[model samples]
Target: MSKVSETTLEIDLRALEHNFRYLKSKLGAETKLLAVVKAFAYGSDMVSVSKKLEGLGVDYFAVAYVKEGVLLRDAGIRTPILVLHPQAVNFDTLIERFLEPSLYSPRILKEFLKVAEAKNQKKYPVHIKFNTGLNRLGFWENDVDWILKHLNGTNAIKIKSIFSHLAASEDENEKDFSLKQIKSFKKSSSELAEKIGYQPIRHMLNTSGILNYTEAQFEMVRSGIGLYGYANDAQIDSELKPVASLKSIISQIHKIEPNESVGYNRAYKSDGYRVIATLPLGHADGIGRHYGGGNTMVLLNGKLVPIIGNVCMDMIMIDVTGADCKEGDEVIIFGGNHSAEDFANSAQTISYEILTAISQRVTRKIKE
Candidate 1:
């Protein structure tokens, strides 16, 4: 409950829990949930976010790299972690930490096997990524035989689960494509399971997939943005709470006259008299330069305050004309009465980018 500093990212734990429950409610008890905690839990603090979800009995946790998993493990998270896009260099660390990698190719699978065999490890869990549609990562459907040839009857890495990503699960225009992805994943998974002589957990649902492709939900589902209170769909978005509230104090207030320029590069020139309030957060803190010179606005006392000039490395200037508040008044970049979507819209970006862009320097205060 106390503020960390002049600027802070207020993470509402209650809202986080609410959002988790809301997403889980959409699925059945049979569906396993893997809470995606990558990118510092969307730049809100993975240690806190993962611990909260772990406390709520989440089935698993996922990260984009081995170090991210190690961070959670070091923080006392005991749940299984699937490294989404693990690199070859971190294989040893991943193995030592028992971090599962999403094996996407024959080469990756072979490399991991060599590491696992040399380490004398057995039955280590590894997820096979199939390129059903998202083509970004994953072994192609035809590579199944090559996968089995390398792993069959070998005392190397064990296949734990198989998954594929949905490219446009949130877009109605891509319904056929999503269905095709599901069908492909299913066929590929079943074929691999038969060849491997057993079934590993099969999952294909990402956040949007869980919402739009319920039938495609296999043995488990990976919910990322939905758990952080975003669904990419207006109907589902209304169901989840906005968990991150970016708030900062108006460190100073100044009165500017006509034709007066503001901030770096002197990009903004006042047409007339205006009140400028400086926020303690800036692009170096994850706001980015795109939000400068009337591109975005911060909310103060329920009124819109347009951002002015080139955003600085440590701060931003907002035209807070006629606002009741002064220096030290609370300024909301996103959250509270103003929504993250609106803030992101003004910046011409998505909620995901805005929420995850907050730099590590911004103190995160967990709201009970």
Candidate 2:
């Protein structure tokens, strides 16, 4: 790979394939895989990532919104996409594009049924999301009967899958809670299936659940961060390669004297003479202001340098003192040897936040 001359997000398709295969190795032969390509494929180019995954034989795709699914469909993605959250207003457009919706509540279910019936559709595929412990979305375990009653007379839609989200699958301390959630999902989904007289595909495992709760993988699994090469666990991280590398070049160098300040509001003061290098990327580029004040470190010519002062909208100043580096030298924000997880850890955040926070304006280059 060549060094980036400007701010760029380099995506490694090989790394993506490797991560996908690694995750698949943990699942059963009959189990299906759903790649979550929402949030611009976690801030990497969504279209490019989805195209690669499609070629790699991903079983399904998931997006958080109907528009995201529409974008994939517009890109000619033929794989079935599950819209994790769908509004009634977009139901017509969603159906037109052949995107499946996750009807998590009675209102959403009724609204979708009305749209489907009005559109003269029969047996349109839809998913039912149950609230096991994630309290964020989905129907309650007891809502199964209500759901059955609503579906009793309608052939406009069919339950393609019954699914739920894991709240703390990555935390070992919450193992008991995750297990209980799994048990509840199983009981609820099973009862619903028996009453409906057909077994809909049952899936509740996300990336972490794929690693921590393999026995409860049900029929399918969803992987987002894992496919981007993060498992939220150190041991699993070693086995997966990160697909995106955020890189930039030093734009300029500054010399600071004792008591002199750097950046806005004099957030960082030099106690002694120091050399600072300004990189052309900041909050506008997705490196938030919280990363300032030496909280985050970047690799400058292979040396870890602390980001000083407040992060500006379009640039950040890093203390590059004593480092054998010059202007135009490549700076690694997070990638390759220095993982995004490590970078996020320095700022007391997670890889998901930093990865998804990346702005779309940054140029994306795919490494085949």
Candidate 3:
């Protein structure tokens, strides 16, 4: 193991196991589970996370890019990996890597089918993504017939699954809209399955949908955040052990007399005789400018300290007056009293953004 840096992201693998077990309990014995490991497994060491999931007998893994899936496979992750957004250019590499692709459009489907046939890839798994509600990637209901017709004579690839995304599964306000999307996704999947002469593993629920709409989890569910020890309910953050704890040591501490300013732009003035601790992390490392000027707090000695002005690219200063912390003491940016949602709320964003926004430079430690 490398020496622990002054700043590091600690990932609790046991907490991941607990979250997986909890999620497994929520689904019936018949329900299949596909763990989504896209975005470097949400910026927390994909190889470690995916290996643990594979050992736990997870049914499959899904990544955002074909290259991401290939990395997992190269790392000896034997679980079936679904590449959610396979571009046409990487289709050959995807096939060479034995990675499954989510064909989002008819053009992609036709191109992938041709490649599969050239390689004599018989019964290779492929999923069809429907744009039921997300309006992002996926085929429309009207294009289903066109999709099936385009591949009328191809035995190169098999329809392994059909899935859709829930746009607002976590919000109760959009129940009607959510239900409509669910209904539409089911209808489209069933129609295509009939045309293909076999039932594809029909899945349409993301992490939020899996929590709220149990009935819509057809044959499988793709979950990301829930696997990382977070729930849609922000109030329950305390119960869910956060998998990533970003901690930095107080690189230095300074005693500021009254009327003294701190950081660039002198955003915060010392009101009285006070102590300030500088963290060796900043916006360039994903803390961002929005967290500047007392918008957020960092934890010191298990107590909260408001971050003073202008988060620089390499460091941030925190007011630690009246605290028992000293130079080289550990400070938490999030993952203790401050959860991902808590930070996001302060920054006027969502948990997903914060979780995936961590810079790659921060060393990640996988806790055994």
Candidate 4:
């Protein structure tokens, strides 16, 4: 990999492959792997990430919206794509692109059926999303009867899989709750399979669930953060390599005298002599304002430096006082030893937020 010349997000494809294989080792031999590549592959260039995953032999791909699936299709991704949240308005385009939709509600089911029937789609693949405990977008267990009734005479669409989400698979304190959710999903999916006279693939594990609940591996498993190299657990995180490395070069260096204010609203007032280094990326580049005022620390020349003053729209200043660093020095916002999880922890957030918050404007350099 080349040294950081500017603010760039370096995506290591080898690290992604390592993470994928690591997560796969946790599943049964026959269990399928569905890679979630929504939100620009969690803010690291969705098209590139999806391409690599497809090459890695991922069984399926999942996205949050119809457009995301379309993007994969446009990129020549041939793997089956499941749209996790399909709106009624995009049913036509979704089917047109052969993107599978996760039908979570009666209205959405009916709307998709109408589109499928109108388009003369026979046995168009679709997944049924059940709300085991997430209380999010999914059909209730009671909705099974209604779903069966609606599908009694339809040949336009077919259920490809029945799945649910685990609320707290990463928290040991919530182990009982996770188990109950898993049990509920099993019961509901079994009931639906018996009534529907067919068994669709059953899956209900995310990245954390994959790590903590191997028994509930069902027929398939979905992984998002795990592929990006995070398991929400410190011990597990050590086993996975982060694929995205946020790196920037010091744009400039300044010497602040005593009582000298820096940045907007005079957020940082130097008490004595200090050295501050300005980085090109700021709030607009996905480093939010909340990370300002010394809340977040960045690595400069192998030393951790707190971000001083308010984050500018396109720049941020970090205290580099007494550091053996100069202008053009590389700064690691998060990656390698200090993972995105570590970075987000400093701001009372999670790896998901920081990873996905990275702006698309940041140059993405794929490390093959």
TM-score of each: 0.97, 0.99, 0.96, 0.99
Residues 257-339, candidate 2, lDDT per residue (tens digit)? 99999999999999999999999999999999989999788998879999999999999999999999999999999998899
> Compared to the true structure, candidate 2 yields what TM-score?
0.99
| Ranking of predictions according to lDDT | 2, 4, 1, 3
What tens digits encode model 3's per-residue C-alpha lDDT throughout 155-203?
Answer: 7888889999989898999999999999899889889988878898988
Positional deviation of 276 in candidate 3, in angstroms?
1.3
lDDT of 2 at 222: 97
| Candidate 4 displacement at residue 186 in angstroms | 0.8
Query: C-alpha displacement of 172 in model 2, angstroms?
Result: 1.0
| Candidate 3 clash pair list | 283-288
Query: Global lDDT of each model?
Result: 0.88, 0.95, 0.86, 0.93
What RMSD value applies to candidate 3?
Answer: 1.9
- Compared with the true structure, the alpha-carbon lDDT of candidate 3 equals 0.86
Top model number, lDDT: 2
Report the lDDT tens digits of candidate 1 across residue range 1-368: 45334788988889899988988897877989989999999978899999999999999898999999999989999999999999989999999888999998878888888988889887888999999877788899899998988887776678889998889999999999989988898889999999888889988898998888888778899988888788888888788888888888888899999999898778999899988888898898988889887978788878888888988999998988888987888888888557787788887799889988899989888877
Clash number by candidate, in order: 0, 0, 1, 0
Give the residue spans of candidate 1 off by over 4 A. 1-5
What TM-score does model 3 achieve against the real structure? 0.96
